[model samples]
Target: MNTLPQWAELLVSFFIILGASFTFIGSLGLLRLPDFMARLHAPTKATTLGVGGIIIGSMLYFSLSDTLSLHELLIAIFLFLTAPISAHLLAKAGLHLELKLTDNTRDLRKKPEQYSDKDS
Candidate 1:
């Protein structure tokens, strides 16, 4: 906005661009990676960082221009907390389903049937 100082504008713009780029790269990785396990790596790390960058930018912009902005921080915290957990769960599910992995992958876990016994 015209009301924002030049430095704040530049900082926000830089972070926003960085965030969008990371998000785009993550999406690209998902499409380009050759295997399911490899593909799972992309959105978990890249998208998390991407969203964090955008959230940081928004938090900075709003904090500087108006009252102390906290919602963005909360969103960032939630993303940080949940992304890895969700990724782990998804990966576990994939493993349980016996999804194809890259040629070089070495699975160390017991068979999915072990999980069934635990669940029972």
Candidate 2:
């Protein structure tokens, strides 16, 4: 006894396709970008948006079918919270390791004597 509009189904499908495209673009950027920081931006930005879009599509589809808000919200929330932290940690670690690139725009390591140690 379900009566759903065709437009709603179409919209949901559109969102799913959009999300998949974003994710694919992100993966391509990760592979094709030249440098570490540049490459870091690809997945962090695009993939996050892509996953968010997919989660939203899931929420809409489930809500329409089940008439319950459900736990898709939690997945979106967790992804938003964690993805940025993971990206930040990755960038920081890369800087700590002093990984260099041909087109590096910023210096990674601190200059010597910038740190003060009385024992020294």
TM-score of each candidate structure, all chains considered together: 0.84, 0.82
Q: Model 1's lDDT to the true fold?
A: 0.88
Best by TM-score: 1
Steric clash pairs (candidate 1): none
With candidate 2 superimposed using the best TM-score fit, by how many Å does residue 31's alpha carbon deviate from the native?
0.7
Model 1 residue 20 distance off true place after TM-score fit, in angstroms: 0.8
**lDDT of candidate 2 vs native?**
0.83
Where is the poorest 10-residue window by lDDT in model 1?
106-115
For all candidates in order, the CA lDDT equals 0.88, 0.83
Which one wins on lDDT? Answer: 1
Taking every candidate in turn, the Cα RMSD to the unseen true structure, in Å, is: 4.4, 4.1
lDDT of 2 by residue, 5-79 (tens): 898788888888888889999999999988887899889899988887888788888788778775988888888
User: Could you tell me the TM-score of candidate 2?
Assistant: 0.82
